[model samples]
Target: MSTTPTPAQEPAAQEPTTQERLAWMGRNSKKLILALVAMVIAAIVVTFSFSLFSSSSANPGNMVGTGTMAIENSKEGIAILTVDDMLPGDAATGTVEVTNVGDAAGDFQLASSDLVDTPATPPLSSVLNLVITDGATEVYNGPLASAGTIDLGTWQPDAKHTFTFTVTFAETAGNEYQDSQTTVDFTWDATQSTS
Candidate 1:
């Protein structure tokens, strides 16, 4: 006789059908919808708060900038002629301390010329008709010798001479002297032949 067939094993319970799932969702739909709505509101609140903080950090109106401008290789003791407060003005004062730095005698002179239209509009040159005064005498006869011209008309090396200029707006005839900033941009001719 054939052995009794083993009891048929029931298949694993399958997932619920779509219709069954929909029926279940219909009963609990309100709670599910509320949960979804709450999540969306939380997401919107977090996004708005982050944006507000980011905007303040990126505001350019409250930013500050600090920059500087300068010149290089200028001769010693020579500085721009500026106003009393060091602001640009119509007049300036500059002083120069020249040294021979060469073996043979050096001959350098301060020759100033008037400048016409310029970047700062002031008619000025790197060179100025400096009214050099020694104690009380206006030394205008010879080139300022960072050295005293003793018997020979020459500058000795390793010697230091100082000259001061009280720059004024009244230059030579017909010079259209503008603001003081123009005097700051000047080139010096320190070409005394070095023997």
Candidate 2:
């Protein structure tokens, strides 16, 4: 009669059951587990890449040392030559041994210093001629006061060299040098050799 007997009223909708809600959550949880597994796999790969490219080294035997430079003479501080009663035309010769007394090779040199005159008037050193020789090589040949630095070449550790010093009273010296006397010191210098 009325319309077509209004369609049977549909049953009221019901709230989701606990089991159905749990089933929905379980489906989403599976997707979440898969994403977490992917993240863990990515982290492992990054760690291995860093380990493969890393490098390291060590040197336990490395060492260092230092060397020394020094020299000595057989006479040390003693005089190489001395005379008291020297006169005109008189000559004296003395020999000394020089050595390199260090752990390294060095360049040796000889020079005169600390000259003293007794009378200080006649200047005895001017009239005294000095000649120094090392084997066959003449190291210096000049007046005692005019001798310059003389190079003795390179010497190795523990090496020894003989030197001869000869002083001659010039025959041309006159009576003014009768009471005049002279004294001097011999100096040895050493420097480390480059070669």
Candidate 3:
């Protein structure tokens, strides 16, 4: 007889009415609006960051590699010095010009490889002496096979430096060096001066 629930003792489980839901939303509206505003501001900042890095312009003044360094022989390009039937005490000479055609000054250095011989039985390079001169200054004077690097000093922009190289067969060479042919190559390097 007491099983029926009274209105005051009814269960509290009930869906929210439209008015209660609207009131709850209204209370939190400021927080929702602030979240949306923050998202929008972050998007704007990211867009501007991308734009700042995407656009590019070229300025010729800021370009590098506009400078040049080159070497030329008296023959206009690479030169060859041939000594046919070389005998003891015989010598040959050649010349080349190093120029800085760029707008920047540079320091120059020279290097030579050991003289290679066709008949390797007797290394003719061991019996050869080399002399290199820049105008009146002797930059290198040593054995052709053992010569290392030589510094030619600094060169100004648009300036040219002339070099003379002489190769001589040692006077002390004997008959064993006969018909032994040798060849040597020279390299010139340039680095831009900082000072």
Candidate 4:
């Protein structure tokens, strides 16, 4: 008898048709594109989060901080008390002016603190020498508003507001420190002596 190959003895598998191959590729390509889009969105979210978390100490949207002290000279503006000298039982008159040296709207608290007693003398309460005056009349007395607020509104190039806080020395406990330039050696800066 002659030996013949049976149909069951054919090759393991047949090659796919062009249409079938295209369908397979299309299915996988959709999944790949979807994954890439998700990854991109996630990266964008992380970048924004990091930027928000790492920022400097600054006010936002045209808000300025009141950090300038009138004691020092400033071109952007200044607050100064004109006085012959800062001493106890002595009167030094000056006005607190809010001048906008820069073209920025700013706010500040302008006030003097209570007289701090130092040197622990024979039991003496140091009095803050001050009297707030509105024009010629004395509106308020005692330390000239320990804490006063000044709203500059809009600086508008060059402009300022002047408010007077005239004060007189009440009573102080310490030594005389009189000098053109001298450091008041006590709990607060006061007259040690006229040098």
Question: Tens digit of lDDT per residue, candidate 1, span 1-195?
Answer: 889989999999999999999999999999999999999999999999888766334545686764322112235444444454222233456665545555544555544444333444334443233355433445553322222322212455564555565654433423343333333333333334446
Give per-residue CA lDDT, model 4, range 92-161, as digits (tens): 6666434445433333333333433333332222344455543464545653324333222223323445
Cα error of candidate 2 at position 167, Å: 1.1
Best by TM-score: 2
Q: Can you give the TM-score per candidate against the true fold? A: 0.34, 0.75, 0.62, 0.31
Q: What's the best-to-worst order under TM-score?
A: 2, 3, 1, 4
Best by lDDT: 2
Looking at model 4, which ten-residue stretch has the lowest summed lDDT?
182-191
lDDT of 1 at 53: 65
The lowest-lDDT stretch of 10 consecutive residues in candidate 1 is 143-152
Compose the digit string of candidate 2's lDDT tens values, residues 1-195.
Answer: 566666788899999999998998898998989999999999999999889989989889888988888777889989999887888899999999988989999999898888887788779999999999997789899999888688889999999889999999999999988888888988999999998
Candidate 2: count of backbone clashes, pairs at least 3 residues apart or interchain:
0
lDDT of 2 at 167: 97
lDDT tens digits by residue: candidate 3, 1-195: 678775686687899999999999899999999999999999999999889868667776664556565543354536446678878898999877777776777888887765578788788888989898888899988888877788878888877778888989988999998878887777777888887
How many residue pairs clash per model?
A: 2, 0, 0, 10
Local distance difference test values of all predictions, in order:
0.48, 0.90, 0.80, 0.45
**For candidate 2, what is the TM-score?**
0.75
lDDT of 1 at 157: 51
Model 1 misplaced regions, further than 4 Å? 1-78, 84-91, 113-130, 133-153, 170-181, 184-195
